[model samples]
Target chain A: MRVIQNEKLRTVLSYLIPFVLIPAVVIGGIAVFRSRGYSYLIFAVSALTILLFVCGFDRRKTGTRRLVLVAAFVALASAGRAAFSFIPGVNPVTAVTILAAVYLGGEAGFMIGAFSALVSNIFAGQGVWTPFQMFAWGMIGLFAGIFAKYFEGRKLRLCVYAFFCGIFYSLIMDVWTTLWTYDAFNLPFYLASITSAVPYTAVYAVSNAAFVWLMAKPFSEKLGRIKLKYGI
Target chain B: MTGFGSINPAAVFAYFLCVTVSGIFTLNPIISVISLAGALLLWAVLPVAKNKRTHIYPVLLTLFCAVGNPLFSHNGETVLLVINNNPITLQSTLYGLFIGIMLSAAVYWFSSFSLIVSSDKIIYTLGFISQKAALVLTMALRFVPLYIRKARQINGTQKALGLYKDETIITRFRGGVRVFSVLMTNMIEKTIITSDSMAARGYSGGKRSGYPLFKFTFKDAVFLAVTVFLTLLTAVPQAKGALDFNFYPHIDITFYGVSSVAAYTGYALLCLCPSVYEGSDRLKWHYLISRI
Candidate 1:
């Protein structure tokens, strides 16, 4: 099942696919292939970006326990998504990813967020927006990890962060819809999309805050205890 | 996995990739129709259990695309109607229809794609790039169901213990969160034990290799070659801008030469390959049984 046999070529491609080839497709699609509905190309680029990060995580030499821990976080987040599937635009994936990132680091958080989207979409349905959703959720976790210090023990700040994550996720998905439907970032159409999505966005933002406020204490305590007891 | 699913996943993936990329990029209504028909045909031919409800989303998506575009863009000369001092032109509406067809075609293609390419196939494909990510995906997939069951168990325990009165929606949600929190702890503890056991078994101590689940047979090669050839046949014309379609101030399709026809044929054949293959495979099985 090896596609690229040579190690050097594989490494080069591992980097090149994400950085060079994907960007070229994105840029070239916009500049040259605009009328051809290049939004799908943008979708491909987003998907590839997630793949690049996953590959980067793969390349890092981590312990087996840490590997398992990352996988567990991903599973928990997606399970959270499945649990809250009845609600539209409200899920604990962002909160769980934030908590995981706050404890594990930005990289692990990103993986958890991205992989949760991929894994959950297996049941919830995958579409052009899958990559965009992954990227949005992954970025939420990444920022949460980066600002872990600010968010730690400050439940209000964590809620605030989750609120913004909700907004960010919706906005990013709207960007995808606009690009997908119109084939360009048509400003009027994008604004129309945002306006139409206002209700969902509000629910998403409020629910994210609620989830964070509810889950923050339990998650922090559990993760902190596990870290101390098991030395993960 | 049977019928179309029996084909090497890589080959199926390649076939879908070509069909989708070319189908969307061609931007011709005629070709879009072919693609939509071909996608629906493939869905019909796949041996997986068919669900009536599953067809609704693509229909709604197509309708949304068709109706939504004209509201936003006011291009073309032939104005269909005037609403709020804005003209809904024929060109924009038709273009929207084209976009809808293209998108729904893609949606159908990918839906069937997910049905054919199961999680194991996905892992096998991802294993080429990064075995670690594949391993994580495998583990995470395994854990999702376990955590779900664990959450249910924890919820039952909490109910039995009279921990929280679950009368209202808020209480139920709180109860769910409590179960989720418990599941999180259980998951972490179990993962640690699993990792420990894996470490004891000398995991990651040596070069890792995966089980060879699929073989690229001669049939696969032939299938892949045909896919590539058809793709190139269409792509050459597409790259040359021979299939350029415009839905702006005017509706124009300039090139209708032999090459353009060839490109359309090539795309149609590429899109139809899977369905045709699946149909033939089913007929062969029926014939073999009848002979027996």
Candidate 2:
């Protein structure tokens, strides 16, 4: 029992160490660089390196085969994001991000959605909205992790949850944007909410339904298989 | 943005600090325009060219805000038109545009800043905090995507089990609630498991060693110098009452002539640094010729 416990501890340490360290190095380096008036290049390169390292570490731990499956799921999710734009009153990114959250578990889903946004936005060009999108999508993933218990093997409940998450995520993102862009106290609450919030919600709801219906099941099962395969 | 590849992180940080400070105190049109131009220049030089389309959405949003502000709230002095017994003032619309432009510029600046400064940098900068606290924050940041992916998978499984057949919106809503409940439960379990794993690894101790990858270099030093010079230039005058002004009805300023030139030069230099340094010799010649 002692030996087994020791082995388990070692395994846990291996994983947790990187998890703890990566953020420290990156954030610290950025602060130092900023204080010193270092270029944005250092920041960008460092960030990219950390992300790649994290993804690589995750893949290595989980097994390459499972990593491929997650990658595929992410790609599908990305495509779903693209498709959402075509549908009136639907936000593909929000729907797909929510679905990815549901199917992949939180961290993977967040990474997939965030990475997809990051990579895709590269083609679209990075703007102030990228971080917001990343944060919003990431929140969807976080919620997924938080909410994963009640969703265990239940489809209808999962769909319903996803829809709400979709709407909620969109609403939160819109509110943030409004706060950042507009003066909240001075402006009438209803007006700001109506102009910015409503339109996004309408689109988010439609996209949530469409994407969830299309890819949720197969992807979920695939993620399960991958999870089991790697003993995650 | 091309030159962002070489520009130091400190300069970018200083730029962000300046913008944020300027924004809080004076959100006037001229200040916004200058800031906007600065942000645009930064964006232009960054490697963001790889993803140009994403740029459009923000521009569209800016346009929407500009147009939307006038149509809704008709307030202010300089009247532009009267419709349906309501006066449309030029001041209000222009003010709206100014606000819109400021918002847009701020947004773009943040985006550029984020792109340059990743989550790692955030953690690194906040290194003085205890490792446990940092770990939790990082985990929270990291957990978002993980949770979303899991929720998505579980949702699919539930749907397949014929749990989503009821078509009514209310039933569907209930069904959604049920799914969320399940997802939440699973997330708790996962969090517990992760926490256990963390604790087992002896994470309860005091400050751990810093991240391995972060190390400063000589280039970093040079970057710091430039950033300091630029920041000081902007901060001294702006912090004092010397650089105060407004843009409405017409461009008005107390600081005219040399002061204006200095301000413009400082801003222009910041904007042009990346371009002048990064451009090819031929492109540099062309730029010089254009300036001439």
B95-184: candidate 2 lDDT, tens digit per residue: 567777776776667666766766555444323222222233355445445645765686688889988645765465445445544554
True-vs-predicted CA distance for residue B12, candidate 2, Å: 7.1
DockQ of every predicted complex? 0.59, 0.06
Can you give the TM-score per candidate against the true fold? 0.94, 0.56
Q: Give the per-residue Cα lDDT of candidate 2 at A177.
A: 47
lDDT of 2 by residue, A1-232 (tens): 0111244554564455457656664554334223112322233333444344343433343432333333434444443343333345543455455555665566666665665565445434565456556656666665765577776566666667667876776666555544444434235533566566676676566547654664456446645653565454
lDDT of 1 by residue, B217-274 (tens): 9999999999999988887776667677887889988876988888888988998898
State, as a TM-score between 0 and 1, how close model 2 is to the true structure: 0.56
For this target, which candidate reaches the highest lDDT against the unseen true structure? 1
State the number of backbone clashes in model 2.
93
Provide the TM-score of chain B versus the true chain B for each model in turn: 0.94, 0.74
Interface RMSD of each: 2.6, 13.6
